[model samples]
Target: MVSRTGLYPGTFDPLTNGHLDIISRALKLVDTLYIGVAINRDKGPLFSLEQRVEMVEAETKALSDGSNSVIKVVPFDTLLMSFAEELKADIIIRGLRAVADFEYEFQMVGMNSFLNDEIETVFLMADPHHQAIASKLVKEIARLKGDITSFVPADVASRLNEKFGN
Candidate 1:
């Protein structure tokens, strides 16, 4: 049988629960899932490229356990389509948390389609529990010493606290 590869790209400055949820859900949809860690300097990530990649790998490692699909963590600093093409991805998975995000993502889908219509982009709405979780918001809450345990994984929460010396 042929296999489908899905690419889920994000900066993941600090991998959040929402991201993991998407990863878990995405695994069910593809034979291989590539967690594309993007090097977006404009976002001014708190974590380094290597750090983000390592965290993503560590966090996603367990998601593939007992599953036939493979999950690879890759770091990229180019156009999203270029990275997707390189991986020969059959689909690009994107997590949408709210209606506000749809407008922007809608435009992105169009632009990406123009670049490569063959590679499809799939949108997965964040689970109800994770609908409010955003990496940026998580970072802010952590910086203020708020309880971010619910929004991020234990390891990531620890790292965020350490970053703010909490």
Candidate 2:
């Protein structure tokens, strides 16, 4: 049996619940799920790459334990498709929360398809309950002392609060 591997790439600047939702769902679709923590210096991430990777691993621990699939959190400093190619992934998982996301991701799919026709891009719609949760907005809410408990996990919320000195 050919094992299916997938790469889910994102900055994951604090690892929100929405990301966790996608990770949990992605596990069911592939034999191995690689959570690619992108080292995007342009985003000016709130958490360092190590921190992001650690947070992903920590949060997904339960998911990994419960599922039959293997889950690995890896940091990447290269282009997304290049990293996927490096992992020899069969698919790239993306989560779409809204039409706005679709517009961007649709373009990405087209470009990535051109990059590697062998690797497929799969889109998972965000659960409606988590549709509005975004890492950047979560950070902004945390910075302003707004409730972020719903947007992130408890550990992530605490980390965000600590980062904001809240």
Which residue pairs in candidate 1 collide? none
Instruction: Tell me which residue pairs clash in candidate 2.
Output: none
Write model 1 residue lDDT over 114-155, tens digit each, in one string: 999999999999999999998999999999999999999899
lDDT for each residue of candidate 2 in 1-166, tens digit (9 for 90 to 100):
8899999999999898999899999999999999999999999998989999999999999999999999999999998889999999999999999999999999999998999899999999999999999999999999999999999999989999999999
Candidate 2 stretches with Cα past 4 Å from truth are none
Alpha carbon lDDT at 19, candidate 1: 97
Against the unseen true structure, what C-alpha lDDT does each candidate score? Answer: 0.94, 0.94
